[model samples]
Target: MTSPLLVGFLASFALIAAIGAQNAFVLRQGIRREHVLVVVSVCAVSDLLLITAGIAGIGAVITAHPQMVTVAKIGGAGFLFIYGALAARRAMKPSTLAPAQNGSARLISVVLTCLTMTFLNPHVYLDTVVLLGTLANQHADSRWLFGIGAVTASVVWFFSLGFGARCLSGLFAAPMTWRILDGLIAVTMIGLGISLVVS
Candidate 1:
């Protein structure tokens, strides 16, 4: 039999390892090596907090009242659409891929933006609260342990993405590389937004 911890870890990782808006933003910040630690910390901590809430039974409350999900869905879709457009514009622009010596934004701004991406996204709630929580509860005797496993996966993934991106700094030095990345980000965000609205 598969361990609850392993199941949780795999499930959480599978849900999160996609090319979503948050991941794209994290990847960009990582490549720039700008506030990488802060970004990773915020993402991981957010996951821990959400997962804890889910395991603590908030998941049941959310599942019982789906209006919350509907509200989140609408707001998240708008946000994703706007963000996607901006990314597309950036991709179309012939901007250099090099990070400015001072970086584009303040660390606080980056943190705030990251927070918006984390909290405002409906999928985050659906995946963490409803899906993961339900899965953990299925383990019954080991639900909390399952949650810990899921949280650990989050910690690992964020830190790896945030830090490991620097290794590709050389590749991202070319304008075309950034263009490609931003283009893909645009498509991903837009596609996800539409799906969220329609689904």
Candidate 2:
């Protein structure tokens, strides 16, 4: 018999594996080795909440509301296009972000940045909450197990990204590297947004 917990974990991991802005930020922070714990904690917690909500049947409501989904799709796509443009713009400019002066500022920045990266992207909710949640329901003998699996996946992924990026920090230190990363981010975001809108 397939355990709901295992299924949920695999499903959650599968959903999060997509390369998106949130993952990008997590990787960048990991590379910088700045507030990696804070970033990972926030992201993991946020995912936990969303996944739990989905397992609790929030996804059913979302699925039932076609109009709401349409509205969300539009809003999300628009936000992505704008965010992509901004990233592209930042890539063009010379980076002037000084290191955080203190631990408090660093913590705050991590929270805010993670929040922006996670919440600002509509795809997160769609994939993790709505889509994954809906799928989990199909095999839900015990919904809580699914939620646990989903949360576990979030924790593992965030930690890996936060710590793993450190291994590649040296490669990304150059200005050209930043530009390329930002450029890719911009293009990816815009492409995703347009695709969402058209489809």
Candidate 3:
């Protein structure tokens, strides 16, 4: 029998494997070891919501609304482009010393940054809610199973990203590392944006 848990786990991991702004931000936080839990929680919760929405038949509505999708795409594309540019610029600038302790403020900032990165990028909705939803429906035995799998995936992904990034921090510490990451982000954002506009 096909285990919903297994399906969900694999699907979620597969989807998140594609590196994006969220992943980038998560990695940075992991390296810094700052507010990691808060960031992961926000990302996990956001994914859960999106995945639920997808499995609840909202995916069809989104797919049917090409106009709405187009608008979202344009907005997402623009946001990504600007965000990428900013990351690149920051990479070019000299790194500043780490800020003094402020746990409350840091936590809030992590949550908000994650929320903005996830919510503002309409592509996230499309990918998690619409695409994943449609895919789940195809494989799910029932709606409940779909939801179960989807949520499970979110939990697994967030924890993995939050902790796993720390393992690679050493490699990412090099000055050239930030430049490479920033450049990749910029290219990805621009490419995605242009693709959305053209399509």
- Candidate 3 ranges beyond 4 A from true positions: 96-106, 138-141
Clashes of 2: 0
Cα lDDT for residue 135, model 2?
Answer: 73
lDDT scores of the candidates, listed in order: 0.88, 0.78, 0.73
Model 1 lDDT vs. the true structure? Answer: 0.88
Instruction: Highest TM-score: give the candidate number.
Output: 1
What's the candidate order when arranged by decreasing lDDT? 1, 2, 3
lDDT of 3 by residue, 46-165 (tens): 888888888888888878886777777777778777776776675675462122221233576678778877886667777888877877787756655766777777777777888887
Q: State the lDDT of candidate 1 residue by residue for 1-199, as single tens digits.
A: 9999999999999988987889999998998888999999999999999988888888899888989989988988898899899889878886534575334668888998899888888888889878898899888989999999999999999999999999998998887888888899899989989998999
Candidate 3 is scored at a TM of 0.82
For model 1 the TM-score comes to: 0.93
Give RMSD to native, each candidate.
1.7, 3.1, 3.1
For residues 24-122, write the lDDT of model 2, one tens digit per residue.
778767866888888899999999888878877887787777676677678767777877887688678755221231123357756776787676566
Model 1: which residue pairs collide?
A: none
